[model samples]
Target: MTQAPPELPLHMRRDHFDPVAELAEVRESEGVRRVTSTFGMPAWLVARHDDVRDVLADATRFSNASQLAFSLPDDPRSAEEKRKALAGQMLATDPPDHTRLRRFLTPEFTVRRMRRLEPRIVEIVDQHLDAMEAAGSPADLVPSFALPIPSLVICELLGVPYADRDEFQHRTARQLDLSIPMPERIALQREGRAYMEKLVAGAKADPGEDMLGMLVREHGADGLSTAEAQDGAAEITDDELAGLASLLLVAGHETTSNMLGLGTLALLRHPDQLALVRDDPDAIVPAVEELMRWLSIVHTGVARTTTQDVEIAGQHIPKGELVLCALPSANRDPSFIDDPDTLDVRRGSMGHIAFGHGVHHCLGAPLARMEMRIAFPALLKRFPDLASALPFDEIPFRAYHFIYGLHSLPVTW
Candidate 1:
């Protein structure tokens, strides 16, 4: 008779800001431990900061492209169809292919580009702040302020119509919710792709000054020159463009919006730290970094599979085995920082892997940082006495989603 695998601890979002207590225990005793993934697959969960960085940094040894059937056990889509749906997501590719795709898109997200958008970002933040103020005290911060700034900025960047935000936002939320069945999530993915396909078609017909138009103009049928084709520019296809666009549209807004909502709640809870960020102009940048490290809103780093047998923190993980990093655990690991669990706005928190580590590190770090740095202080200064409208315990956190965040943050001045 064979022995059954041990039951794994739940790894979904938490109702509170803290990571599950079990992760802290595992990090201390067994930095790399075998656990069952939410998808029902066996995986090695790396918790310590150093070990997590090692796994993420070594792309050759840990392949991001290794297809783990994270889909529901009853998923109706075939493997090939699923693969096609995930094809152009930068997070799903590795090395040469990843490098190629990133090269084309990176120029658009550089610090210089993000700086150019900063004035407009500040304007958008103020506009939302204006709306929140007009509504009087006791407003739901998520919809009133948190969601709109990033949503509008990304819409302008991608040339996506702001009027269509609700549809895409709904689809993104459902798709990231772990409780949503695989079949339903797949349907959402298809719907998002169809929407992007229509947008890509429009961009190809008459290119605008947005990212989509730039992509179509540089890589589309009418765009690529013979020399450009020789350099692999023509390799991009309409389907691939749609996939890429959809990924950007979803990722650009969802992650930042959640950060804005969750970060606000965090600062409200830590009044001293909130005062530091609100009162000191110099503290704003480092405060954003510390908040990212402290919150680790993206609960899991992208999952990878071992390319060969590997030893991580004394555990022998076999070739092709699934591997995941518990980001919240790593960010809060005592070895990563002094008083790791405390929210300190003054600390630089520069080395934390909140944006992740190595090649797949977040491309939009500059943009996200600018948004947070601008939005937090502005909201704080605008309403100096902002406080939670509901009891902290009563405020619902998004416990079912892969990206941890608040469902809504009710606040009043």
Candidate 2:
């Protein structure tokens, strides 16, 4: 097992809604600096917006499929089995394979497809709001509203039984937590895979209209047409299906839920911006974008490896080196936008790499945007006097997780 590196100040730190002060200093001075990853590997941390964008857009140069292994707990699975398990996750693949998987999944996440989900999404938000209202004030909005709306939506979309949400959600939370022991995290990963396996089996038995079923119908045993096969659609193994479903189930809800929780807290902190979001219907769209950029819930954009020696920000990075882009730092760089630290809902849409940049960008970004656009306004409208139940300083932030967010946002009306 690889030993953990000596503790160092990580660039990914978030002080409530803002990145740690050191991150800003590093961004301004170094731009591109060598840093150690949590997994104990050395990586070049890119902080400038242009440099980060360059690394992300040029996948051929920065390969996402680089085999940098984080220390995992002891498990029975052979190295080959573990590699196979990771194969179906789009984030872990590069180029032709990533392109192929994304091509099959893109239709489900298209703007049109996400738009069709709007009515249902609005209804879901309202239902959660109603429940929150019924529960009265001083509610922990994290579980009450933030987590459930996207969880329910993704569950229905992926054909995961909503009744089993608690189990899967718990597994996801544990898996992403950096504080959790490696063994526990590994166990959670297995548990999640097992749950997904069952869903894959059901999809195989009788394909429903959901995304999982679509995968089965088009690429599984349901059989594809000659044109479908000729177009590069091929039958996916059950393990691959399970891997895909697990990624969708976990990624689909976790990030958005955290955004909902953390974004609300951010708005509460900036009441003036909150007012803009609450009262101005036209501001909602850009508000969501600004919040995504401001909060930068995902601290480290996807990690990549240098495919070849490359120069970034005047620094020479050798081939096969780990590269980690600081999304929060890049988004907050002065070069990216004016007053990058301030959360201005009316700032209009800036080309912020919140959902990331390039081919490996987030697939559920459209759905996430829709959820927030509906959710923030609806929550504010419902509880016109909504404010934090606990003091701002008391709200716990998930600083150690791969995704940055509030652990619980206790609020009152």
Candidate 3:
């Protein structure tokens, strides 16, 4: 007779959501197998690095086209609408459609194009630290620095007004909660999409140099009718456009913010690494990689559905089943990363799953890395004795969410 795996806590139910010891147990466990959850969803948790990479690289059998499977909505009505609405967005499609949707923005987000934001990113980092200094030595860095810096940078790129950020930033946490009722989640998604619709409409009527405006001017409506065009513009429907904008805002803000906060927490916990970077800010470049690897903020990669039946690592996934790539587990794979648990700055993490793998990899990765490369060193250099305001465990870490992070990284120098 065998005992079943323990159930996840309500507060920690987000998939790939982090709980170190538990994750390690599942990650290091043998074979790709079925994990029946209290949520009633039967999922195949791919814990090995090679297996995760295999699943991600082979998309014919597994399609991003089915974003419906990825959605974990607590409400039926909103879930159905959201699941239906996003089918038009890039993340929701496979092949030809995904390629078309992702292609338009790829060139702009390239390494070269992202380089232009470095100066601005650095300036933003300095500004945040300066603001932190002015307020008080011990201040909550999460909102003041971590949140605003990336939020501001992404908003600027999207042509969203700086003034409007406060509202979006305020709503980001609640909107991102997977535990929130499906109706609430659906409403939040609609509000975000609606906001982006207005923004895109404004950009079309009167152009700007931002990504949204460029997208409108450059990519004429691919298949949408005048009615749909009235809805928004170009290759995507209004709902799709809204989904893209909402995704960009949420992705741009949360992931980078968590990396910054959690990365900082990792450093504070490891003094030797802290001293290494404090002496030479240049070390922040590789240091950020190790941080990404060690922090591995996203619990699971994007939810993918099996477009067709597939056998990976000798484990058969029947057609239409849910197969999710685990980011944290992959990053810590022993085959690729030596001493996968230890945080080694010099370790070659170029292939790390921190951003992800294949075409659907994070478009904003370069920007996030740039922000961190600038932000971390600046924070350490500015505050030599930076210390947490509350007891480490007392600080509010994000619970029950895919993006593992702290709610407010309170600190003082």
Clashes in each model (backbone N, CA, C under 3 Å)? 0, 0, 5
The models' CA-based lDDT, in order, is 0.84, 0.84, 0.73
Residue-level lDDT for 366 in candidate 3? 86
Ranking by TM-score: 2, 1, 3
* Model 1 stretches astray by more than 4 angstroms: 1-9, 13-15, 68-72, 222-235
- lDDT for model 1 comes to 0.84
| Model 2 residue 12 distance off true place after TM-score fit, in angstroms | 2.1
Q: Write the per-residue lDDT of candidate 3 for residues 251-337, one digit (tens) a residue.
A: 888899998888887788888888887787667778888888777787666567787778867777888877777677778777877
TM-scores vs. true structure, each candidate: 0.94, 0.94, 0.89
Q: For residues 1-413, write the lDDT of model 2, one tens digit per residue.
A: 55553353376677778898878887899788888886666788888899999999998999887753543335567777687578478888788778877877888999999889999999999999999888888799999999999999999999999999888888898898777766778888888888788888888889999999998888784444322433455666676678888898889777999999998888888899889889989989999989899988888866888888999999999988888889999999898898999888888484999899999899889889998999999999999899998877888988778898878988989
Displacement of residue 124 (Cα, Å) in model 2 is 0.8
lDDT of 3 at 400: 48
Provide the global lDDT of candidate 2 against the true structure: 0.84
Q: Which stretches of candidate 2 lie above 4 Å from their native place?
A: 1-9, 68-76, 221-233
